[model samples]
Every structure is written in structure tokens, then in C-alpha cells.
Target: MKAVYIAKHGGPEVLTYGDRPNPEVAPGEIMLRVRASALNRLDLNLRDGKNYRGALPRVMGCDIAGEVVTISPNAHTDLKVGDRVILDNRTKCGVCESCRMGLDQNCTNGKRLGVDLDGGHAEYVTAPAANAHKFPQTMSFTEAAALPIVAHTAWHCLITQAQIRPWDDVLIQAAGSGVGSMGIQIAKMMGCRVITTAGSDWKLLKAKELGAYEGINYRTTPDLSKRVLELTGGKGVDVVFDCVGADVWEHNLKSLKPGGRLVITGVTSGTKASMDLSLLQGRPLHLMGSGGRSRRTFADMMKMVRQGSLHGVVDRVFPLDSVAEAHKVLESREYFGKLVVES
Candidate 1:
């Protein structure tokens, strides 16, 4: 099978696209004819070996949508060969206490697909049979491929972690990002007023179209916290979904109302930030870091997608063989939504 693999941790240049040994289906696993895969910032970090190091020659892609090719004899699922499914990114030992409680992402033995195992950057891939969920007939493979990571992450951050309420004033950072695009729609779906930030005018315009009540151009408005305060009539937002990390850490703190919730998932910007203990204590804020969303969350988001309440925003699609170019486009941050690589 032809796949892209990283022989060593480095830049996009290290990605090799060529034929390799075809993956054989293992017991309790499901083999897939990979249809499409989406790129995430985690892919870039794993490629650079910044976090979650893996063995050499690892295929890298997390958001996968494909057709079932074969199911192991030991595995059981409602899906069968030719059924379209979305691969869950989070893998866990199902017998673990966390898994028993339906918190697969919190399992101590959890390993992410594409990070701990070879992922769907190829014509064929395999996943735990339990990780495959049948997608709606209305969803295209490209659309399903673009959803898992961002939708699950945003759902966990806003709904599960932040416990967001209707009419809450919410601020989402980097609205042009995959997660931010989903965050905007989810917040709006919950009846919250959403304010999102983007680096460019067109992205801000697009963010508004996706349901953001207001868009902030962070390039022009350096003190974005002040803008938040003004937009909120001096009270500040009730919840902040911040993925930019350290670069906007202080601003995120200041943009919140007293006791506001701030949930962070990614550190695209640098990871170090200085915070004032006095301000933290005075405001009694709830600051949380969320990652590795549970399978349940992914399934719930997919259900919303099927109902037409939530949608995946895809920016572009590249052929599977052109993964290097896809990486370049993702790194440039020139796209407004998720980037998909089709097999």
C-alpha cells in the first residue's frame, strides 16, 4: 500500500510517500480502505517530535474516514464491509476503570491513533473495531474525515469541561482554525453569543458566517482583552475557548468576567506564559486544559452532524500522495477550515 511515513522527526520534507507492506488485519481490529484524512496541529508536533514521540516510519494522520474492508473474526460491530465509518482518534483499554465509566480519553492506557499507532495517511489502515462508528449517509468521506478531532475537542472544551450555558458570552481564539470553526458553531448552537479572533479580515468575515456574533482581528487589536470588555458592555465574556496558548494567555485571563471559565486545548503559540496570582485569586476564575476527547463526545458530535445542527468546515482537499504540500498549507495558516487529504 502507498502511504506517507516519517523516517525521523523533522519538517514536512521528512514525509516519504511510497509503497510499503500492506497492513494485515489483527484480531479485534478492523481494516479500512482509507477514503480521506484530515490534518491537525498535533500532526505537526508529532512530526517535529515535540510531544508524544513514536517509532520511526510512522504514518501520521488522526482524523480518518474510510470504508470497512474487513473485520477480524474476534471483533464484533454492527458495521460490515463497505460500510462508511469515521475512525475515533482516541484509543483506550476498554476494561480500564475510566473506560468503564465511558471516559476513554482519561484511561491511563490510552494511546491516540496516528500518535501511538500507524494512522490513515495511506490507501489502507487498521483500527480497533470498537473505534469505528458508522457515519450518516448524507456525509461525504471528505466531510466525515474533517470532523473527529476538532469537533470532539471543542465539544469537550465547551460542553464537558466549561459546562457552558445558554446566552453566555463566549470568546473563541483563532477562529480560522479547525477547532475554532467548530467551536463557533457549537457555541451558537447552544444559544451563546460568540466572539472569535482571526488574523485576517476574510477569516473574520468567514467566522461570522459560521455563527460568531463578533470577530476580532488580533493583528490590528493587540489588546484584544479590551475589545472583549467593550463588546460585552464592560463585563467581559462568561467563557473563553483559548487554543493559542501562551501568546494570548494573559489576554485570555483579562478578557474573562469574574468566575469566568477558560478552557485551553492547543498551544500553537509558545507554551510559557506569566500569570498574576493576585488577579487569579481576585477573579476566582476557572482555568482548565482539555485534550484527547472521549469517544462518547465524538459520537455525540457526529449525531449532531447527522441532524444538520453541526457541520464540518473543510477548506481544501489534497490527494493522499501530496501530503507534504498539505502540511505546507496547514503550517501557513492560510486556510479557513480543516484540510483533507483524500486517498
Candidate 2:
């Protein structure tokens, strides 16, 4: 098999593409003829030495969409050979308390693909049967590859964490991002009134095309909080999606209405945030940091994908060997949606 991997963490240049041994299929696992695998911030984090250790060489990619060629005899009844599918990169120990409660991502003894575990940056990968979902007949492999992580994160933040409701006004920062663009769509799906921030007029127009009630160009209007207040007639938004932490932390906090909630799923800008102690009492706010979703949550997200209720807006496609270039593109923050790496 040919795969891209990192022997040592440093930068995207550490990603190596070359011949590799065939993946071993275990009981309840299937080997895929990988058609496509998408990149996530997690891939770049692991490659740049922020997340994983170099104890084991790593093939880094998370969302995988492919056709199954070989299946272990012990595999369960839900799937079989020749099935087109998308595999969730999240794994959980079934016996753990969180797993028993259906919170698989929070399992005490679990692993993530492309981080602590080997992932899908190859021509073949072994995926657990439980983590694979049959691809919809109408969806292409490239589209399927873009969904598992971005769509799941958007669903977790809007539907599960913030509990968004129809008619509620919401503000999403970095509206041009893969997750942010997806988040805008998901919020619109729930009938929420949404305002989002992008850096340019072109990006703001793109966000508007995706159903944002209003688009604010952070580059043009530096006084975003004041603008938000004006847009809402002095009533701030019901929720604020603040992935641009530290730099935009206080600004986002000021955009929310009294008793409003803020859902944070990432900190691509910076991790640290300086919160004013009095803001808690002055506005009566709630801050929530959400990570991966539960098994049921991801399944529900897949259901929407199959039903055409949610669609991942992919920006570009890259080959497995061009993993380094993909990282540089994403790091530049220029793409409107996701960039996938096809195997």
C-alpha cells in the first residue's frame, strides 16, 4: 500500500508519502480501498508537534470515505464487502461508563484516528465495523469524506451543546472556515436567525449565500459588538460561536444578550481567554466548551446527511501526497470550506 505518514513531528514537511505494508484487518474490522480521506485541524496539530508524541510513526487523516474490499470473518452483521461507506475516526471502549451512557467520545479508554491511532492517509485502512456508515446512493465519495468531522462538530455545537432554537439570533465567528460555514448551514436548518463574521467582503457575501442573516467583515468594521447591537435593535444575539478565542474573546462576549450562551468548539486563533469576572454577573452568561459528539449524535448527523437536511460545503480536493500543501492552505485561512485529501 502507499501511504503518507510522519516519523517525527515538526511541520507538514514531516508527512511522508511512500510504499507501506497492507493494513491488518482484525475481528469486527474491514479493510478499505480508500477513495478519499479529509484533513482536519487535528492532522496539522499532530504533524506540528502540538498534540501527539513520536513514539509511533503515524498516518494522519480522520474522515474516510471508501469502498470495502476485504472484511474480517468476525465482522458484525451490519456491513459487508463492496459497500461504499464513511468511517467515523472516533473509537470508544464499550465497557467504559461513558460508553455505556452513549458518550463514546468521552470514553476513559478510547482513541482518535490520526492522533493516538493510525488513520486514513493511505490507499488502505482498517476501520471498525461500528464506526462505518453506508454512503448514501446520491452522495459522491469526495462529499462523504468531508462530512464525518466538520458536520459532526457543527451538529454537536449547535444542536447538542447550545441547544439552538428557531427564531433565536446567533453569531458565528470565522464564518468562512470549514466548521463555521457548516455551522451557518446547520443553524439555518434549525430556523435560527444568524449573523457571522468573516474578514473580507467576498467571504461575507459567501456566508450570506449560505443563509447568514447578516455578515460582518471584521477587517472593515472593527466595532463588531456595536454593529451587532445595532443589527439586533439593541437586543444582542441569543448565542455566540466563539472559536476565535483570546483575540476575539471579549468581543464575542460583548455580542451576546443577557442570559445568552456561548459554545466553543475550537481555538485556532489562540487557546487562552481573559474573561472579565464581572461579566458573569452583569450579563448572566453561560460559556460551554464542547469537544467530540456522542455515538448517537454522530449517527443523527449521518441521518441528516442521508436525508439531505445537511450538506458539507467542500472547498477543494488534494491528493494524499500533497498533505503538506493542504496544511499550508488551511494555515493561510483562505479557503471558504474544507480541503480534502483523496487517496
Candidate 3:
């Protein structure tokens, strides 16, 4: 099987495409003839020598949609050969405290596909039955491939952690990002009023097209929080999704009403964020940390995709052998949604 791997961690140039042994299916696992995969910032991080610190020849892809070509004889009701499925990025040790509570991402012994093991960048890959879900036949593999990561992230932060409700205004910082695009759609599906900030005019327009009720251009807006307050008629937002952590934290915090929720998943915009402790105490804000979605969330989200209420916006496509290019695009932040890799 031919797949892409990080020959060394430095740049996209480190990505190598070549043949490797076909993965052997283990009991309680299924071999998928992967048709398409999507690139996330995590993939780029690994390529650029960030969080992923592993041995050489690391397979770097997490989001995948594929057909089950073979199934091990575990006889689990959740899986069978010939069923179309999407890979779940998170896996857990069922014995862990978090896993026992169905919070797999928070599991003490959690593992991520692609980072800790081989992922779906090749013609075929094997994954635990519990980590892959049968997808709707009506959708394309490219679209299904886009669901696992961002959709799960959105579900985790907004649905599971924030407990968002209808008519609530939510602020999504960096609405042009791959996760931001997913967040916008997710918030809208939940019946929340979505507001987002983008770095470019094109990105802002793209966010509006994806159901954001209001789009603010961050590049030009000097007083983002003030504008957000005005947009909500001085009420502020109920929740603020801060993916661009340091750059948007203070601004987003100022935009939130007293007792408002602030959910953060990533610090994509550097590591430091300055906050006013006085305002935090006076407002009694609910600052929360959210990341790593569960299997249940991924499964329920796929149901929404199958029903046509949620859509995966694909920004670009590259052949499985061209993963280096995929990493480049993600790092450039030129994409409005996902960068797909076809197997």
C-alpha cells in the first residue's frame, strides 16, 4: 500500500509518499479501503514539528471515509465488513475513569489515530470497531471524511460542554478557519445566533454563506468587542468559541455578558492571553476548557449529516500521495473549510 509519512518533522518537504506493507486487521478491528481523508491543523502541526513527537515514518491523517473491505471475527454489533464508515480520531481505554463515563477524549489512556498509530492516508487502514461509524450512503466520501475532526470538535465544545440552546448568541472567533466553518454550521443547526470574526473579506463572506448571522472583519476592526456588543444590542453573547486563543481571548471576553460562557479548544494564535481579573470576578463568567470529542458525539453528528442539516465545506482536494501539499495549504490558512486527501 502506498501512503504518505513524515520522513522528518520540519516542513511539508518532510512528507514522503511510498509503498508500505498492507495493514493486517486484528480482532475487533476492520480494514477500510479508504476513499478519502481530510487534513486538519493537527496534521500540519505534526508536519511542522509541533505536538506530534514520534519515530520516523509517521502516517499523518486523521479524518477518513472508507469502505470496510474486511472485518475481524470479533462479531461486534457496531461493525461489519462492506459497511461504509468514517474514522473517529479519539480512542480510549475502556477501563479508564473518563472512558467508564463515556468521555473517551478525557480518558487517562487515550490514543489518537495518525498520531499514535497509522492513520487513513493509505489505500487501506485498520481501526478499532468502536472508533469507526457507518456513514450515510447518500454522501460522498470526501464529505464524510471532513466530519470526524471539526464536526466532533464543534459537538464537543458547543453541544457537550457549553450546553448551548436556541436563540442564544454565540461568538466564534476566526470564523474562516476549518474548525470555525464547522462551528458556524453547528451553532446554526442548534438554532443559536452565530457571529464570527474573519481575517479577510473573502473569509468573512465565506462565513456568512455558511449560516453565520453576522460576520466581522478582524483585520480592519479595531474594537471587535465593542462591535459585538453593539451587534447584540448591548446584551453580549451567551457563548464565545475561541479557537484563536491569545489573539481573540481578551476581545471575546469583553464581548460576553455577565455569567456568559467562554469555551476554548485551541491556542492557534500564540500562547499568551491577557485578561482582566476584575471584570471576570464582577461578571462571574463561566470560562471553560473543551477539546477531544467522544464517539457518541461523532455518531450523533453523522446522523445530522445524513439528514442533510449539516454540511462539510471542502476547501481543496489532494491525492493521497500529495499530502505534503495538503499540509502547506493548512499552514497557509488559505482554506475556508477542510483540505481533503483522496485515496
Candidate 4:
């Protein structure tokens, strides 16, 4: 099997594309022929040894869509050979305290596929049978590959955490990002008026096509909160779904209505920020962080996907051998939605 693995962390140059041993199906696990894998900022962080530390020679992809080729005989699953599916990268120990309490997202014994285990960047990969979910027949492998991380994150943040209402005015930061784009779609599906931000005009246009009611070019708009207030008739948004932290922290706080909710999932920008203590007491705002997503919420997201109300947005596709180039594009942040690599 040929895989893209990193033995050392530094840059895209550390990604080694070469032959590796094919993974064997372990108990309670299924081995799949990789069809497509999507890139995330986590991949870049892992590749560059930023914040994350892991073992060497780790395969580098978390968002996977593939066909089951082999299932361990002891695996208690209905999945069969040739079934197409997308995977939930997080694996939780079923007997953990949190899992026994039906809070698997908070399980103490949790391992991520692309981070803590070998992921689906190769010709084949193995994952727990419970993590695999069948995608709709109408969906392509590339589209399915794009859904796992971004869709799950956005769904968990907006629906489960923020509890977004249809009448709410929502603001989504970084419209060009995978989670940001998915957030716009999810918020719009709930009938919320969505205002989104991007670095460029074309990206803003793309965001509007995905259902954002208004788009702000943050590169030009020095005062993001002012524009958001203007868009909302000066009341500010009812909910803010932010992925870029620190850089937008103050603006996100100011752009919210009194008692509004703000859910943050990522901090691609620097993480440190100073918040006015007075604002917290005065507005009594609700601040939430998107922790690990639950299997229940993943199911909720898949239900929408199956209903055709939600779809993965694919910005570009690259071949398996061109993973380095794909990583470059991901780092450049020049594309909207997901950048996929086909096996």
C-alpha cells in the first residue's frame, strides 16, 4: 500500500509518499479501500508540529470516504464488503465512564483516527466498525470525504451547542473555510438570516451562493462589528459561529446582541486575546466552546445529509500522489470549502 505519512514534522516537505504495509483488520474494526480523503487545518498543525505531538510515520488524513473491503469476523456490524461510507474520526471506548453515561464525546479513553491512529491517506485504512456511516447514494466519494470533520464540527457547534433558532440572526466567521461554509448552510437550513465574512470578494460571493444573506470582506472592513450591526439594523446578531479565534474575539463579542450566544470551534489565528470583563457582566453573553462532538450529533448531521438538505462543498480535488500540493493549497487558504485527495 502507498501512503502519505510523516516521520518528522516541519513542513509539507516532510510528507513521504511511498509504499507501506497494508493495514490488517483488527477485532471490532473494518478495513476499507480508500476512495477519497479531505484535508483540515489539523493536518497542517500535525505536519508542522504545532500544538499536537504524536508518533512518527503517522498517515495524515482524518476526513475519509471509502469502500469496505474487509471486516473483522468478530466485529458486530451490519456493514458488508463494497459498502461506501464516511467515517467519524473519533473513536471512544464503549465502557468509559462518559460512554456509559451516554456522553461519549467526553470519554476519557478517546483516540482520533488521523491523529492518534493511522488515517485514510493511503490506498487502504482500518477503523472501528462503529465509526463508519453510509452516505447517500446520490453523493459522490469526494463529497462524502469532505463531510466528516467540517460538517460534524459545524453541526455540533451550531445545533447542539449554540441551539440556533430560525428567527435568530447569525454571523459565521471565515466563510471560505470548510466549517465556516458548512455553518452558513446549516444556519440557513434552520431559516436564520446569516451574515458571513471572508478575506476576498469572490469568496464572499461563493458564501452567498451557499445561503449567506450578506457577506463582509474582513480584509477591507476594519470594524467588523460595525458592519454586522448595520446588517442587523443595529441590534447585532443573535448567534455567532466563530472558527477564527483571538483575531476576531473582540469583534465577535461586540457583534452579538445582548445575551447572545457565541460558539467557537477553532483558533487558526493566534489564540491569546484580552476580553473586557465588563462586557461579560453587562451583556451577560453566553460563550461556548465546541469540544469533542458526540455520536448522537453525528447521526443528526447524517440525517440531514441523507435528506438532501445538507451537502458537502468541494472546492478542488487532487490525486493521492499530489498530497503535498494539496497541503500547500490548504495552508494557502486560497480555496473555499474542502480540498480532497482521491486514492
Candidate 5:
């Protein structure tokens, strides 16, 4: 099978596209003929030597949409060969206490695809059949592949961690990002007033098209907190959804109302930041760092996708062989939504 593998973590130039042995079918697993896989910030980080724990010569991709080629006899899923599906990518021990309690994301033995195992940056990949979700018949493979990682993470951060309520004022940073754009849509669906930031007017306008009520061009207004305060009539937003990390940490803290919450899912920007202790001392605030979602939460997100209530925004599609180019596009941070690769 032809695949892209990283022998050493450094840059896109390290990605090698060549033949790799086909994965064997394991009990309780399904072999998929890869159709499309979407790029995420995680992929960039893995390539750039951050948050990655896997060894070299690893296949790296998470958001996968494919057709079932074979189902292991030991698997109990209702899916069959030729069925179209999306990979969950969150590996968990189903019998673990956390998993039984619907907190699979907290499972003591949980592992993530691409990071912990070979992922979908190839012509073929294997996944636990139980982790595969039926794809919406209405969506193309590229669109289906774009939904899993970003959509689930956004839903988990906003609905699960933030516990957003209708009429709340929400602030989403980096509106053009996959998760950021999805966060804006999810918050809007819950009837919240959304204020999102982007580096360019084009992206800000695109964000509004996706449902954000106000767009802040961070390039023009570096300290977005001041503008956010002005937008909220100086009261600050009820929730600040941030993934940009340190670069906007202070701004995120300041843009929130007293007792408001800040839900963080990723740190795309530099991770370190300096802060004054008195900032939080003056006003009570809640800070939440959310990770992967449980199987139940992913199912809920799928329901929304099927019902057309939530949708992924695909900015471009690249062939699997052009994996390097895909990383370049993601690192450039110019795309307004998800970028996909078709195998």
C-alpha cells in the first residue's frame, strides 16, 4: 500500500510517500479503503515535534472517511463490507470504568490515532469496528472526513465543558480555523451571540457567513480584549472559547465576564504566557481544558451532522501523494476551514 510516513519529526520534507505493508485485519477491527482524510493542527504539531508521543516511521492523520473493505469476524459492529464510515480515532478500553461511565476520553488506556497508532495517511488503514460511525449518505467522502476531529472537539469544548446556555455571549478565537469555525456554528445553534477573531477581514467575513455576529480582525486589534469588552458593552462575554493558547491567554481571560468560563481545546499558538496574579483575584473565573470526546458525545455530534444542523466547511482538497503540500497549507493558516486529502 502507498502511504506517507514520518521517519523523523522535523518538517514537511521529512514526510515520505512510498509503499508500506498493508495492515493485517485484527479481531474486532475493520479494514478500510481510505477515501479521504482531513488535516488538523495536531498533524502539524506531530510533524513539528510537539505533543507527539509516537516513534518514527509513523503514519499521521486522524479525520478519516472510508469504505469498509473487510470486517474482522470477532467484531460485533452491525456495519458490513462496502459500508461507508468515518473513523472515531479515539481508542479506548470499552470495559474501563471511565468508558463504562461514558467518559471514554478519560479512559486510563485511551490512545489517539496518528499519535498513538498508524492513522489514515495511506491507501488503507484499520480501526476498531466499534470506533467507526456510519457516514451520512448525503455527504461526499471529503466532507465526511472533515467532520470527526474538529467537529467533535468543538462540540466537546462548547457544549460539554463550557455548558453553554442559550443567550450567552461567546467569544471564539481564530475563527478561520477548523475547530474555531465549527465552534462558532455550534454556539450559534445553541442561540448564543458569537464574537470571533481572525487575522484577516476575508476570514472574518467568512466567519460571519458561518454565523458569527461580530468579527474582530486581530491583526488590526492585537489586544482583542478591549474590542471584545466594547462589543459586550463592557460586561465581557459569558464564555470564551480559545485554542490559540498563550498568544491570546491574557486577552481570553480579560474578555470574559466575572464568573464566566474559558474552554480551551488546543494551543496552536505558542504555549507559554506571563500573567498577573491579580487579574483572576479581582474576578472569579472558570478555566476548562477539554480534550477528546466520549463515544456518546461523538454520536450526538453525528446526529447533528445527519440532520444538517451541523456541517463541516471544506476549504480545499489535495491528493494523498501531496501530503507535504497539505501540511504547508495548514501551517500557512490561510485556509478558512478544513483541508482534505483523498487517497
Candidate 6:
């Protein structure tokens, strides 16, 4: 099998595309012929040795959509050969206390597919039978490949953590990002008025097409909170879903109404920030962090996908051999939604 793997952590140049041994189907697992794989910021962090410190020579893709080819005899699943599916990258230890309690997101011994094990960057990949969810036939493999991480993250953050309401005024940071784009759709689906931000005016236009009620070009409007307040008629938004951390921390705080909620999932901008202690006590704000997502929430998100209410936003597609170039574009942050590589 030919795949992209990193033997030494560095830049995109460290990604080696060459022949590697085909993975064997282990018990409780299924092997699929990978059709498409999507890139995430985690891939860049792992490649540059900033987030992961594991062994080398690991395949580098987490979001996968593929066709089932082989299933271990002991695997308990309803799926069959030739079934098209998207993968849930988080593999949890079923016996863990958190897993046993139906809170698998907090599984103490969880291992991520693309991070802790070989992922779907190759022609074929193996995953736990339970992690494979059959996707609707109407969906394309490229779109399915873009759904898992970003959709799951946004769903978990907005629905499960923040508990967004229909009447709420929501603000989504970084409209051009995968999670940010998904957040806009999810918030709109719940009937919330969404205000989104992007670095460019064109990206904001794309965001508006995805249902963002208003778009703010952060490059021009450095004080994002001021515009957010004006959009909300001076009361500020009821909720804020933020992915860019420290760079927007103060702005996010100021953009929220008293007792409003703010859920943060990523920190692409630097992580350190100073918050006024007085604001927390005076405003009684609800600041929360989006942690690991569970299998249940993944299923909940898929329900929306199956109903055609939610879909993956594909920004660009690259062939398997052009994965290095895909990484370059991901790092440049020049595209909207996901960057996919077809096998």
C-alpha cells in the first residue's frame, strides 16, 4: 500500500509517500479501502512535533470515509463488505469508568486513530467496527471524509456543552474554518441568529451563503466586540462559539451579554491571554472549554447528516500523491472548510 507517513517530525517535507505493508484486520476491527481523507490542524501540529510525541512512521489522516473490504470474524457489527462509511477516529477503552458510565468522551485510555494508531491516509486502513458509521448514499466520499472531526467538534461544543437555544444570538469565530463553518450551520439549524468573523471579505460572503446572518472582517474590524454589540442592538450575543483562542479572548468576553456562554474548542492563535477577574464576577459569564467528544454525540450529529440538514463543506481536494501540497494549503489557511486527499 502507498501512503503518507512521517518518520521524523518537521515540515511538510518530512511526509514520505511510499509503499508500506498492508494492515491486517484485528479482532473487533474492520478494514476499509480508503476513498478519501481530510486534513486538520492536528495533522500539522503532529507533523511539526508540537502536539504528539509518539513513535514515528505513522499515517497522517484522522477524518476518513471508505468502503468496507474486510471485517474480522469476531467483530460484532451489522456492516458488510462494500458498505460505504465514515469513521469515528476516537477509540475508547470500553471498560473504562467513563465509558461504562456512557461518558466515553472522558475515557481515560482513549486512543485516536490518526494520532495513536495508523490512520486512513493510505489505500486501506483498519478501525474498530463500532467506529464505522454508514453514510447516506446521496453523500459523496469526499464530503463524508470531511464530516467527522469538524462536525463532531462543533456539535459537541454547541449542542452538548454550550446548550444553544433557538432564540439565542450566537457569534461564531473564524467562519472560514471547518469547525467554524459547521458551527454556523448548526447554530442556524437551531434557529439562532449567527454573526460570524473571517479574515477576508470573500470568505465572509461564503459564510453568509452557509446561513450566517452577518459577517465581520476581522482584519478591518480589530475590535470585533464593538461590531458584535452593534449587530445585537447593544445587548451583545447570547452565546459565542470560538476556535481562535487568545487572540479573540478579550473580544469574545466583551461581545457576550451578561450571563452569556462562551465555548472554546481551539487556539490557533497563541494560547496565553489575560482576562479581567472583575468581568467574571460582575458579568457572571459562563466560560467553558470543549473537551473530547463521545460516540453518542457523533451519532447525534450523523442523524442531522442523514436527514440532509448538515453536510461537509469541501474547500479543496488533492490526490493522494499531492498530500504535501495539501498540508501547505492547510498551513496557509487560504481555503474555507476542509482540505481532502483522495486515495
The clash numbers for all candidates, in the given order, read 0, 0, 0, 0, 0, 0
Candidate 6 per-residue lDDT over residues 1-343, each given as its tens digit: 9999999999999998999899999999999999999999999989999878998789989999999999999999999999999999999989989999998999999998888899988999999999999999999999999999999999999999999999999999999999999999999999999999999999999999999999999999998999999999999999999999999999999999999999999999989999998998999899999999999999999999999999999999999998999999999999999999999
In model 5, the runs with Cα more than 4 Å from the true position are none
Among the numbered candidates, top lDDT falls to: 6
What TM-score would every model get versus the actual structure? 0.97, 0.96, 0.96, 0.99, 0.96, 0.99
Ten residues in sequence with the least summed lDDT for candidate 4: 48-57
lDDT of each: 0.90, 0.86, 0.85, 0.95, 0.90, 0.96
Model 5 Cα lDDT, one tens digit per residue, 1-343: 9988898888899888998899998889999999999988888778878767577789888889999999999899999899999999988888889878877888989887777788998999998998899867888999999899889999999999999999899999999999999999999999999999999999999999999999999988887999999999999999999989989999998999998999998777777988777767778888899866788889989889888988879999999899999899988888988999999
lDDT score, candidate 2, position 133: 87
lDDT of 2 by residue, 1-343 (tens): 8898888888777889987788898888888888988878767778878765645587888888899898889877567789999988888778988888877778888787777777888999987788888868898888899888888888899899999999899999988887888889899989999899989888889899899999999988999999999999999999998667778888888899999999998888888878887989998998898875787888888888888987767888998889889889978888887788888
* TM-score, prediction 4: 0.99
* Root-mean-square deviation (CA) per prediction: 1.3, 1.4, 1.4, 0.8, 1.5, 0.6
Task: State the lDDT of candidate 1 residue by residue for 15-96, as single tens digits.
Answer: 9998878899888999999999999988988898878566878988988999999999989877789999988877789888
> Clashing residue pairs in candidate 4, if any?
none
RMSD of 2: 1.4
Clashes of 2: 0
Query: How does model 4 fare in lDDT?
Result: 0.95
The TM-score of predicted model 5 comes to 0.96
TM-score of 1: 0.97
Which segments of candidate 1 are over 4 A away from where they belong? none
Task: Output the TM-score of candidate 6.
Answer: 0.99
Model 3, poorest ten-residue lDDT window?
72-81
Candidates, ranked, lDDT:
6, 4, 1, 5, 2, 3
